[model samples]
Target: MTKSLQKSQSSPSLHPTRRFYWDTESLGVVGLFTALSKVVSLMVALLGGGMNPFTLFLKNGIATALLVVLVARVRKFGTLALYVLVGQIVSFLIAGGGMSMLLPSFLVAALASDALIAACGGYRRIGAVLAGVALYDLLGRAISLGYSFLHARENMAMVMVAGVFIVLGYLGCLVIGLPCGAKFVKELRHAGIIREV
Candidate 1:
C-alpha cells in the first residue's frame, strides 16, 4: 500500500488524451527555467563585459549550471532543445539579427544532446542528464567555432583566439557548473521542490 501511494505521489499529472505529452506542470517548469537562463545570460554579459576571461567563465558556468538543473527538473525528452529554441527566440528579438547567426549551431547541439540523453536511459538517470548538459556545451561551442572560421576566413588567428576562450568556458562548465548544479539539485530535493523518483 505504501509503495503504491509513493508511486502516485511522484508520477506527474499527465495529459488526459496523450500518453506522451508535456502537461501543464511540466510546461510551467520549462518556461520558468527558460526565462531564468536568459535573464542570467544577459545580466552576466552586462556585468562582466564582453568575452574576456572573467565573462567567458562566469557566463558559461552559470548558464550551464542552470541548464543542468533545468534538465533534472524537467526530466523529459526535448527539454534541452525546447530551452534553446525559446531562449534563442528571445535573444533574437532583444539582440536583433546578430543573435540569429548562432541559432543553427545551438539548435543542432541541443537536439543531439537531447537524443543522447534519451537513448542512454532518459532523464530519470542522473548520469544521462549530466552527460547531456556537457555534450550540449561542447558541441555548441565547437559548432560555433566552425561557423566563426567560415565567416571570418580572413582572420583565422582571431578564430583561434576565440577557440581558446571556448575551451576555457567549457572548463568552467566542467569545474564549476556541473558540481554546483548537482549540489543545487540535492538541495532542491531536500526542500521538496524536486521530488525524488
Candidate 2:
C-alpha cells in the first residue's frame, strides 16, 4: 500500500495551462535596468563628447553596466545585446548623425561591450560583468580617438581629453553600478531566483 501511494504521488499530474509570475518579475527587472541605461546615455549625449573631450565615456560605461544587470536579472546576454543593438541602430538613424562618424563608433562600442560581457563567467556575479563592460567602453573610446587622430583631426590634445573622459566613465560605473548590481544579485540569490533564469 505504501509503495503504491508513493508511486501515485510521484506521478501526480501537472497543470497543462498554468502560468507564473516569474517572467513578470524578470521582465520588470529588465525594463528597469534598460530604462536607467537609456537615461544615463541621454545625459552622456547631452554632454556632447563624441566630437570633443567627452568621447561618450559615461554613455558606454552606464550602458555596459545596465546590460550586465539585464543579463543577470532577466534575459541571456545575446538576447539583450541584440535588443540593445537594434535600439541603437534605430536611434542613430533617427538622430541622423553623419554615418561616417556615427557608424563605426556605435559598432565599436556595441560589439566590444557585448563581447566582453559574454566573456564573463555565468550570468550572475555582476562585478565581473561590469569590469568587462568598463573595458569595452574604454577600448571603444580608445579606438575612436585613434580614428580621429588618424583621419578626422589629428590632435594630441584630443586624444588626452578622450582618455581622461574614459577614465571618468569607468569611475562613474564604479560609483553608480557596483552597489546596485551586488544588491540585485543578493536578492535574486535569496529568492532562489538565480537558478530560474
Candidate 3:
C-alpha cells in the first residue's frame, strides 16, 4: 500500500481508543460516579422517606445530574453500559433486592442510550449527551413500571399511581437534572478537570 494510504488508514482521527476501550481514567471516572450515584440515592431514600413524589424527583434529578457528568467525563460509547452494570451489581450486593428484576431494564436502557448518543454524534455534542441521558432515565423507568405491572396485574390502580410518580421523577430529571449537570460540566471544564472532548 502507498505510504499516504497507510497513514490515512492509521490516522488518529480514525482511532478507536475513545470509543471502544476502557482505560484507567475511564474506569476511575465511572467508578467515582457510580459510587456517588449510589450514595446519593441511599441518602435520598433515607432522608426523603422513600418514594413519595418529592423524593422521587429529588433522587432521579440528582442521579441524572451525576450521570451527565459521567458521560461528559468519559466521552465514550460503552460508558453508560459499564455504569449501569456496576450500579446494579453494587445495589444487589448492598441492598439485596430485585436485582434480577431490574438489571435487564437498566442494561437495555444504558445500551440504547449509548447507541442513541453515538448516532446523534457521540458524547462530544451536548445535545446528544442530554438526549441520551434523558432516554436512559425514561426507558428505565418505563420498563420498570411495566415489570411491576406484570407482577401486580390485579392492582391496575396501584400501577397507574406508580406510573404517575415515575413521570414526576422523569420531569425532574429533564428540568432540574439536565441543567444542573450542564452547569457542572461547564464549571469542571473551566477548572480544567474535564477537558473538551
Candidate 4:
C-alpha cells in the first residue's frame, strides 16, 4: 500500500477541540438558562404568598435541578458555577441587594458543584451531575436557612422542620431531573443541536 494512502486510512478525521472557557454558544446557552431560571424564581416568589417554606423549597429545588442538568449537558467545569454567580448577581440587584446573606450560600454551592463535577470525572457521568445538583440544592437551602435563623431570629425548631421538607424536595428533584436531563441531552445530540462532550 502507498504511504500516503496508509496514512490517510490510519488517521481518524479531525474534530474541533473543545474550549475550556465560555464560547459564544456556551455563553448564549448559559445566559438563556440563567435568565429563564430568574424569571421562574420571580414567578415562584410572587405565587408563594403565605406558602410554607417546604413548598417554596420544592419549587426552587426543581428549578435548580433542571438548570444544573441543562448547563451540565451544554458546558462542563466552571460554566454552571458561572451561571449561578451571574444568576445570583442579577437576582441580588433585582432585590436591591437585600439578600446579602444568600450571596455566600450561593457562591459556596456553585463552587462545590463545580468541584464535585470535576472530581467525579466530568459531566459525562450521571452520578456526578446528579450529585452536583443535589449538593447545590442542599447546601444552598441549608445555608439560607441557617442565615435566617441567625439573622432573622427565626426559630431553630421551625427551621429544622423546613429543612426536612427541603431535603425531600431535593430528593424528588434529583429523581425526576436526572432522567429528564438524560433524555433531553439524548434528543439534543440526536438533533445535532449539541455535540457530545
Candidate 5:
C-alpha cells in the first residue's frame, strides 16, 4: 500500500479500548426489545391500576438489563455496565426527572448487577442473566434502605416496599429478561459481534 494510504489506515478510527462499547449489532436487538418492553409496560400500567408505577419500573428495568446484557455478550461487562448507568440517567431525564440532586438510584443498581454478572462470567447463556436481575433487585433495595436511613423520607416499611417492588420487577424480568438475553446473544452471534461457541 502507498505510504499515504498506510498512514491513513494506521490511524485508528477509535481508541482500541472503545471498540467494544458501541456494539451496533447488539444495539439492534436491544432497540427491538426496548420498544416491546415499553409498549407492554404502558399497557399494563394503564390497565392494572397498580401503585407506585410497578409496571413501568419493571419495563424500564428489564429493558435496561436486556440492553446491558446484549452489550456484555460481545464486550466486557464493565464497559457495558457504564452504558447501563448512563442509560438510566438518560431515561430519568427523558421521563421528566430532568436532573436533580442525587443521581438516580438505578445507576447504582445497574453497576451492582453488572458486577455480579461479570463475576459469574459474561453472559454464560441464561444463568448469568438471572444473576443480573437478582442483583439489580438486591442493589436497588439497598439504595432505598440507605435513603430511608439517611434522608428519613421513608421508614423501614417503605424501604421494605422498595425491596418488594424490586422483587416484583425481577420476577417480571425473569419472565422476559432471560429469553431476551438468550435472543440477544443469538443475534450478536448471527451479526458477528460474538462468536458462537
Candidate 6:
C-alpha cells in the first residue's frame, strides 16, 4: 500500500482508543442507570400502580435527564443513544424478558434522542438535554400506546385514560425533570464530577 494510504489508515481517527474513554464512561453510566431502573421496576411491581404511566414518566424522565448530564460531560456524540439502546436490552434481560415487546420503542427513542442532541449541538446545553428527554418519552410512550390500541386487549376508554396519563407524564418530565436536571448538572460541575464545557 502507498505510504499516504497506510498513514491515513493508522491515524488516531481509526484507532479504537480514540473512543475508549468515552465508551467506557458511557457503559458505566448506562450500567448504573439500568440497575437503578430495575430497582424501580421491582418497586413498581410490589406497589402495584407505582409504575403507572404518570409515575413511570417521572421515573424515566429523571433517569434520562441524569444520563444526559453524564453524556454531555463526555462531550461525545451518540453516547446517549448507545446508553438507551444497550441499557434497555440489559435491563429487559434482568427483568426476565417481560418487556421484550417494547424493545423497538426503546430503540426508536434512542435514535430520536441522539438526533435531538446532535441538532442541539451536543448535551452541554440544557436545551439539548430537555429535548432529548422529551423526545425519548414522547416517542417511547406513543409506541407503547399504539401497541396497546392495536392489540385491543383493553377497552378503548381504558386505553384513552392511559394515554392521557402518559401525556401527563411527558409534561411532568418537561416541568420537573428539566429544572432538576439543570440543577443536578450544576451540582456535578461544582463537585468536579462533571467538567464545564
lDDT of 4 by residue, 100-196 (tens): 5477667878888879987987787767776787777678767766765665465777777656766666665666555666666567768877666
The alpha-carbon deviation from the true structure for residue 180 of candidate 6, after best TM-score superposition, in angstroms, is 0.6
Candidate 6 C-alpha lDDT tens digits along 1-197 = 69988898789878655645556655777667656655764664456475476566666556556655655566666666666666667757775565567777777677878788879876777677767766776787788788668666558997887677767766766776677878888888899888774
Worst 10 residues of 1 by lDDT: 11-20
Ranking by TM-score: 3, 1, 6, 4, 5, 2
Clashes of each: 0, 1, 0, 0, 0, 0
Clash count, candidate 5: 0
Error of 3 at 161 (Å): 1.3
Model 2 root mean square deviation, Cα atoms:
9.2
Q: Of the candidates numbered 2 and 4, which has the greater TM-score value?
A: 4
| Model 2 TM-score, 2 decimals | 0.54
- Cα deviation in Å at residue 153, candidate 6? 3.8
Every candidate's lDDT: 0.84, 0.59, 0.88, 0.69, 0.59, 0.69
Residue 178, model 2: lDDT of 56
lDDT for predicted candidate 2 compared with the true structure: 0.59
Task: Write one digit per residue (lDDT tens) for candidate 2, span 76-138.
Answer: 544444445555565566555443354556566656666666676644556556665555556
Over 1-197, each residue of candidate 5 has an lDDT whose tens digit, in order, gives 69977787667783355465557665655555445545566666767665455564557456645554554554446543555545455556656553323355666677777777777776654566567766765565566456545654457777667656656665655566556666766676679766655
Error of 5 at 180 (Å): 8.6
Once fitted onto the true fold, the runs of candidate 3 whose alpha carbons sit more than 4 angstroms away are 1-20
- Candidate 3 residue-wise lDDT, 53-88, digit = tens: 788888889999999999988998889999989988
Q: Which should have the higher TM-score, number 4 or number 6?
A: 6
Candidate 4 wrongly placed segments (more than 4 Å): 1-20, 44-58
Single out the weakest 10-residue window by summed lDDT for candidate 2.
49-58
- Which 10 residues in a row give candidate 4 its minimum summed lDDT? 12-21
Model 6, position 172, has a per-residue lDDT of: 64
How high is the lDDT of residue 1 in model 2?
100
